[model samples]
Target: MVLCELKQQLDELLALSDGYAYCNQEVGRLACVQGQQEAELTALHTSIEAQNQKLLASTLARVQKEGAIRKGLEQHQQKLVAQDGQAEVLKQQLAASNLARESLSTTVTTALKKLALATSTQAQRVDSVEERLASLVERQRECEVQPPPGWATYLERNAVSLVALAVAVFTLGLNLLG
Candidate 1:
């Protein structure tokens, strides 16, 4: 019975190790995704800021140049119209970037929640397994010091030798299985 329980615990340990490895891999992947999203969001904000500055400069230039030049008012108006179109285009791009940022933020949040849950669940399982192993070890010690009623032959001197040989063989078999 002890050997079977040991084998079961070993199997559980193996499975837990595999799950731990998989969780680590998923956490790494999520981290990479978050990093990439942050970089992209930062770059988008930079682009938006630069475009706003450019728009402001162009507006100021148009105001100053409009008053200074009268002979080519028609050409100035055409240039103003072109600048207005570019500004509109930049506004649309900024809106799209904001939308993309929101979507990525949601994805990152969900991934973080899932990773946290998986980590906690694995920790709980590990703790439970450790408790079970500790209990088993304590029980083994008790059995060795005072054999159970079913093992009453332990009171005989020759039975001690037989029981010791059996234990040695069991341990050897367990080692081989392990």
Candidate 2:
């Protein structure tokens, strides 16, 4: 009986040592799994930080592009305003030119009408002077053969006066024509 008890105790101690070794191996496997999980989490954090940096660079480039676009738009707006002002000035100049053209047309018309009236008056005066000159020439030719007397001298003086009047009339007609 004493030998049997001693064998049983030894078997129990061996079974306990086996249980402890199995528990220690399981603990070591659990520690390795936890280390792998930590490494994966660290890699994920590094990837997230790199993505954030890329996003920041992209955002800064977008902001700069937007600022340039805004400046370009402002410059375009200023050019449009200047063009509009120039257009208004051109419109005013056109209106003034049209008014000047109309005024010149009216002046030309008035001058033409006045010239026509003056031409007609000059024509009537020329006709009347020509008729009077024809009559005086006939009287002077009849007096050329008459005998000398006091009345004949007066008639000769009258012939000289008629010649002077004809010369005056011719000079006035030439002036009116020019």
Candidate 3:
């Protein structure tokens, strides 16, 4: 019964280990995805800032030109509108990414919690199994030192007598057959 329980506990521990491994893998994957999204967002922000700087420089240059000033103003307005649209799109993407990141974070936290619980349970089971095994080993050692009831007496008395009786019976049978 103890051995069966130990085997069951071992199986449970193996299953928990597998679950922990899977959770860790999922956490890594989510982290990678989050990092990639953050990098992309940073790149987009940098590009937008660079574009704004260029627009400001171009506007200043056009302000000094007499005939090109009005045309430049119109073009600048159009560029600003396009930039606004791009900013809105970026805002939407950022919001979406933020939501996704939050969701992934929650999932990772839950998985980590489950993994921790499973690990703790497995440790407790191992300790229990170890204790039981130790006790059984001690009992086995004690049994080896202590013989069972009448074992030595039975062996000593019966051994020689049984051998002599067998020898006599064999001799008698052989003489009769001859």
Tell me, by TM-score, which candidate is best: 2
Each prediction's total of clashing residue pairs, residues at least 3 apart in sequence or on different chains, is: 0, 0, 0
C-alpha lDDT values of all predictions:
0.57, 0.59, 0.58
Model 3 worst lDDT run, 10 consecutive residues? 62-71
* Best-to-worst TM-score order: 2, 3, 1
Displacement of the residue 21 alpha carbon in candidate 2, Å = 0.9
TM-scores of the candidates in the order shown:
0.38, 0.41, 0.38
Q: Select the stronger candidate by TM-score from 2 and 3.
A: 2
Q: Which residues of candidate 2, in runs, are more than 4 Å off?
A: 1-8, 84-178
Model 2 residue 60 CA deviation in Å? 0.7
What would the C-alpha RMSD of candidate 3 be, to one decimal place? Answer: 21.2
Tens-digit lDDT track of model 2 for 18-133: 76566556555655655665576567557655755665575567557556655655565566567875555555545665565567556556755755675565556556555655
Report the lDDT tens digits of candidate 3 across residue range 102-157: 67556556755755675576566556655655665565555456433343544464
Quote model 3's TM-score. Answer: 0.38
Show the colliding residue pairs in model 3. none
Better of 1 and 2 by lDDT: 2
Q: What is the lDDT of residue 143 in candidate 3?
A: 45
